[model samples]
Target chain A: MLARLARARTGGLAALVAVVALLPLALTNNYHYEVAIVVGLNAIVCVGLNLLIGYAGQISLGHAGFYGLGAYGSAILTVRYGWPPAAALVASTAGAAALAYLVGRPILKLRGHYLAMATLGMGIIISIVIATEDRVTGGPDGMAVAPFAVLGFTLAGERVWYWVIGAALALAVWLSLNLIDSPAGRALRALHGSEVAAQVAGVDPARYKVLAFVISAVFAAVAGSLTAYYAGFITPAKASFLHSIELVTMVVLGGLASTFGAVIGAAVLTTLPQVLTLLKDYEMMVFGAVLMLCMIYLPRGLVPTIADALARRRR
Target chain B: MSTFTLKHFTRAALAASLAFGAAAAMAQAPIKIGAFLSVTGPAAFLGDPEQKTLELYVERINAAGGVLGRKLQLVSYDSGGDAEKARTFAKRLIEQDAVDAIVGGSTTGETMAVVPLVEQAGVPFVSLAGAVVIIEPVKKWVFKTPHTDRMACEKIFVDMQARKISKIALISGSGGFDKSMRGQCLKVAPNYKIEVLADETYGGGDTDMTAQLTKIKNTAGVQAVLNAGFGQGPAIVTKNFRQIGLTVPLYQSHGVASKEFIKLAGPAAEGVRLPAAALLVAETLPDADPQKKVVVGYKRAYEERFKQDVSTFGGHAYDGLMLVVEAMKRAGTTDKAKVRDALEGIKGFMGTAGVVNMSPADHMGLDLTAFRMLEVKNGDWALVK
Candidate 1:
């Protein structure tokens, strides 16, 4: 039974890679491709966030600030300082990772709602700074981003970015899967199941918690930088407190600890509103209704709950 | 026989080339004007009317043979008054909707978020949002039809100085636009020789302005109060002043210039004054003003079509869409480059709101001189001396 489950997970991951690789052909339109690209970006962040929330059992309500930092880092470096986009992407992730590490050491000590509030405050402060510093981030108006360039070739159009992001996402998933199989991954899983038990079992609970926080922040930041280049515009809204909530919701709605679920969740939430535009006058109300229904009915999320039901029926 | 065949072939080729050129010109689509406003949130009061302006103007242009013989197609989106949502919708409009120009700004935050999108798309945008920074960064593509918060501050302070009101108080909401305006008001207060007696703030949607109002009303030598917000700002003028029994004259920011303010403020809005562009006076405009015909025509048309009274927000949209159409008409093509040049080079262009004369140096083309002092009389904005 365990071997079959492992095989099924691996098969799912492979199928995901194949679909992402061929997303452009399936979408067949620039608008559709753009939505798919956004889904990929969100998935990258969700996968990293999943490590902290799903596996390590931590919550971060301020992940969007790291994402914003990544976007602004790339934008300011390329547009203002004239640095290459690739270098800016690295700088942004490093910056977010370092900051998250510094802040998480203190804040991660608190559990549940206390940790959530601390992270939320960090995000609000970052958003306010970005918004008020109009001279640097162009104030609230935002700034243009230089297009993505890799090894002396300009990356333009939807299809090219689709392949690039797809490959990156696959690598990230593969790395995460390997991490889950490794010893440290087991420590994170142990902590998720029970922090007190993990500590009794010789895991340094605080150290692992902070490590996961920094890793998740880095992922969000890198995703943001890539998004900035793709959209050719970066705004402080990327770091807004609500954006962080949206990112977290994608992970929660997808089912925690499930890589495939994260990807599915991002794609659905990002594209759902575009399709829901037909609601017009009742768009937000309808959106709220859908969210309520999803929470009430699919509490364990789309993947795990459905799989568990199917297994039970078979038994 | 060979000579005759050559001549005929040459003539046929020339005719075909001319036909191709004509077809290409005809195939050029009508210039698309996208109207984005907060249709479903706090700024909905403003955006609802802004939509009407877009609708009525497009209908009028189509009725009058249209711009350059092509009807204007107005595409509207709801920004929801959220800055992030505004950014996303701006991208969708430019990239997916393929709009020729974009107009929005029911709030300072949303307008500012859209500036980069306009710059990246190189699409001309005129925001109704009143942040001065929306235009000051010299983004080539972004302009504003609404007066800036800085402009609003200057207008009020200048009026205060002219009236010899030395001590005043500033009460603002904590929302992004409110805070921005409050800062601008304080920044320029010193310049106008008016001392800020007190400065107070409350959170957005907080109905009890009593704390801020009490603080302001009790300040010694306070002769004026600049209410620095929209929507609830007028409610302060109505409720707080009478509750606290403070009878000093209240000067509202142009953000409060709307019939809805009068409706909400009830009898207290009777003599409250503010500085605004001409759309605020469209309903009560005198026949003698040269632009009265266009102004009144729009007011009636907008009301009939959208089933709502127009606000300055709608007026800005009206001017924004017209400005884009005027440029398109002058360029005789929807080619973005030519349209941009025509927009920047706009001269003596009469809009319902103001006479816009753009140059390479100034995108708005209208300044403090464009505003007139308007007073609320008989539940309508009357042009006051």
Candidate 2:
């Protein structure tokens, strides 16, 4: 562990993860903790998304549909249907996976801009359906989520969820790190590089691509389930196209293909609004400006660029 | 340096000076209310008037000594009707600028997005948005001055029964408020002897509502079509009716009371009846209704300030802020619980929305008395009854 910590890249990531895990300790207010927990949730979603967008060289401008479905599915099942939170989570994940599998087969076949539109339409349709089915989903009014309960222990308070989301984020990060270094991960990277080249290399691009989509979707589903349980309220906006854009922004801004970047991106984007609250009416303008600046200044995203800097200094 | 270089330098200096001037104006000390609106998006037409209303009301309040005896300041953020942006701006209002209260995001969707942020911080939130779910389940920290969709639907159906219009076609957006409106319409329709012939649905940003309207048009014995949503309400009133050649009387959801709806639907809006909170038709109201003196003044002030007509969207926002101020005065401090108590316990308070009579059980104090039947006469909302 000490040896791993001695390496610049690995050490930095470990320390960063520890800081994030310990964030609630420094945060006194529920609002701050809420923001921190949400950022962690977003980081979890972004991690899987990074693998798909960064490692697989694909675009999704509609992952929020999956996230929304997962959130509403978990909330409705657990709260309304009297299912266990864990069972609801499983249902949510399974449902999202099945939906992704069905949608991805046709949508993924459409390639490029067409795929983007197809995915976007799916997201829009989901949003519309959730909004319309008021008796079941609570429509635009948003549905209340069931609290996370395990073995008859109900999870309440910011402190509880701070830990819960923090732990989940940690496990998600570890899984991504391990997966990115695996043989399948290498094949994904090959596919990311060039579809034709990857096929020639016997990479089975279609299989890997579909697998990546499913995995990314599962990650989003888990995050959505966690969000519903934690926030205790879920709306159709969870699946909005703008939300999908935000998820992608978190991945790209964090450093796509970099495990630590996802977390970093989520943390920065989430907290930036909090800090820029002084802008009041001009907050959106400032947010837009910051995004533009980030795109222009750090094209590779924050984590990777920071890693590069630290590595350069060490050399 | 050449003449060209001097000209470039002069232009840059002018730009810098203008920037400095703007910065100076923005930094002025005042008791600020940070508002999140749905301007420049799908809800922009409704939101722009609200933006105008906030500015006008803030100006009115300031001219009238402002809230808490300090000049009430307003710094508005546009959410573009997006939930994430609404959440972001809500945080910005509370954590960053420390706004006394927040107002004006155009939909239930936008208001719901801001609920957690305000509730967590214990800030008094007054939404202009018409979603009952925003205040229902009683967060104790949030409130709205507008008549909810369910209440409006209930009111409309009651009127429909009075008019003996039993057979109705219902079309609604697949949103929370729309669903609520439709459900309430269906539930109370039977009570009022109104039968819903067809239940049609549409989603956000769908420009065409013809297919659903056509289905309703073909239905036998459909006396009136009740559109229980926004965005596409007036378009449905105009294009679909003319396209299907159905002249059955059309009733609308309160969401259609926006000025843009009148513009969007053209002359087809003339005979359409909708339950509106009194603020929309204030201008054409008879001089001595006497009860609407404040509303009339507000309409006049809003028009004078914005150089545009006032709509129900901003009217509710104006009423919400006024209610907050009244509560603050009654409570004598910005105590969240006191403000909440004062608001919940309010009685006989005349506002642009209506005579607001808040109670513990009823968060929204307005009712059918808050609205009279309003029609579009000469491209503006006029009191029909």
Measured by TM-score, the strongest candidate is 2
Q: Give the TM-score of candidate 1.
A: 0.77
User: Which candidate achieves the best DockQ against the true structure?
Assistant: 2
Q: Model 1, A1-315: lDDT tens per residue? A: 322332375776777776776655567555566677778899899988888888878888999999999998889888889898888899888999999988888877776656677788889999888877766776665666778998989988767888777887887777677777788888989988887888899998778888778888988998898888877766676798878999889888878887666777787788888777767678778888987798799997766666677777778
Assess the local accuracy of residue B155 in candidate 2 as a C-alpha lDDT between 0 and 100.
78
C-alpha TM-scores of all predictions: 0.77, 0.84
Candidates in order have lDDT scores of: 0.77, 0.77
lDDT of 2 by residue, B1-385 (tens): 6999999999997876577436344334456677888876777876788887777777877898876666777878777776656765677678766776676667777787677767778887888777666767777777787787677877787777778788888888765556677777787777777778799888767778788888887899898888887666556546677767879888887767777787788877777788876676676678877557888888788777778777767777778778878887888755567877888888998888788888877777776778777777777777766
C-alpha DockQ of every model = 0.20, 0.25
Model 2 chain B: weakest 10-residue lDDT segment is: B20-29
- All models, RMSD in angstroms: 7.3, 7.9
Residue pairs clashing in model 1 are: A134-A139, A141-B112, B105-B129
